[model samples]
Target: MADLVTPAERRRLYTLLSPAYLWLMVAVFLPLSAMLFFSFLTDMPQDAPDWGVTLGNYAEFLSNPTYGTLMAKSLKLAVTVTLFCILIGYPCALVLAKSIKGRAREALFLMVILPFWSNSLVRIFSWAIVLRGNGVLERAINWVLPFDVRLNLMFTTDAVVIGLVHSYLPYVILTSYLALQAVDDDLIDAARSMGASKLTILRRILLPLSLPGLLAGAVLVFVPVVGSFMEPRILGGRMGTYYGTVIEDQFVAVYNWPLGAALSFILLAVVIVILAAASPVLKRAQT
Candidate 1:
């Protein structure tokens, strides 16, 4: 097939792909190269008279325990959020794909996906409104119960988790739903005919079959959550000083561009390693 294309066909193919390839080079490759170049420098060279390339930026991360601790915290948060999303979203997807039919399913799916249409920042801020003390949640709880309630989740880890989950839950549902749609009903019916319990069928058949999609969604959720800054800042307040926030601070507040660039590269390396680790499992699940 590679050799079958004439010169004109190859030219047309390259012509069709050129714009996207060029855009990728400009948008992604160039910025990464610039960041890598800056990461070795002792300081940002724009105004400084004595700027030179050094390994101190990388050394900062290696020598200091604080950054490592914060990075571990970020990883923990990402894992927690990804698990919660999987637990919550996969069920919604199963119900949507296996149980519902026609227009109702379509409507519910649209409702599920409606959040993706809205601004994420706006959504996170709205959660702040709901999670804060004396907000609608407190009022509603107070209304439901006889006791007086004053809820204040503001500036808490729980609040941050909630915000992050709300932002990313739809991704898992979408991916899992797509995977479930490909599952044949006959397989399930056959399992039923063999007197298999519901749990057994789900564990043995559905889970293994859908693992690839679920893992894909989880990776999507995990990668961004690890690098998240906004939700923590708004919802976590004083308690929100995670690795990403520190990276932001290094660049924006501290003006330690070299350190920031080094941290960013380190983060990139972490993500790449994670994806490399996960790829084999995902491929196996697909098979």
Candidate 2:
């Protein structure tokens, strides 16, 4: 790879990559290092005159079960959303990749991925409008049914789940579609020639081959969803409190920067562990 590039080409590559690396070092790494340092302190140095390093924040988390429960709730939410995304998105991907063709397939695929082009905050809020009491969803239901029915989904766990699923569904679909699309139609036809049913082909061929991409998409959705705060707050309302919201409050509402930093660092560590666990499968997919 190195031998293929001229000195000028190498210089151009270095020039393009250097700024990104430098930006990561300054913007992300430096702040993260500072946050980690702050997490061990008794108080933020800016506010407290006699600040000192301490393990009190971590100790607080252990001593109080509330934080642990909230973290558990967050993990549960992540798992639920990931499962739903896989169930719903994978089939959509299969249809787009295998069932559809030409311009229509392209159009549908574009529609599937179009959500990513818009702001996520806007999307979540739109769900809130649709799900709230007597909102668009209820009205639509009422219009069709003989009796008036109220589907007050806002400020509920279900709403949170819906919002999250809608937001991250594209991730699973995009990855799964790419993986399934790579599968040759000839292989599937050959399976049919052997008198294999559709379900059998999907189970034996499509699934095994696409498992890595599915797992990759799950990881993509789960990690960020675990750390999500805004969607829960907007869609779940009073019932929206989760680990992410707690970390957010520690910084913004409570102004306990140390505790916030500690929580944030722990979340980052958990995310790293998750990615590390999934790395082997992702590498296998590439091969």
TM-score of every candidate: 0.95, 0.90
On residues 1-287, what C-alpha lDDT tens digit does candidate 2 reach at each position?
55846888888888989999999999999998999998999998889899999999888888989988998899999999999999999999999999988999989978888889889898988998899999999999999999979788999999999999988999999989988988999999999999999999999999988887888798899999998999999998999999999999998999999999888878888789878887886788665
- CA lDDT of each candidate? 0.91, 0.91
lDDT of 1 at 130: 89
TM-score of decoy 2: 0.90
- Model 2, position 119: C-alpha lDDT score: 97
Tell me the alpha-carbon RMSD of every candidate: 1.6, 2.6
- Which candidate has the top score in TM-score? 1
In model 1, which range of ten residues has the least summed lDDT? 1-10
lDDT for each residue of candidate 1 in 1-287, tens digit (9 for 90 to 100): 38846988888889999999999999999999999999999877886879998999999999999999989999999999999999999999999999999999989988998889999889988988888998878888999999998778888999999999988999999999889878999999999999999999999999899888898889989999998999888899998888999999988899888899999899989989989987888789999
- Residue pairs whose backbone atoms clash in candidate 1: none
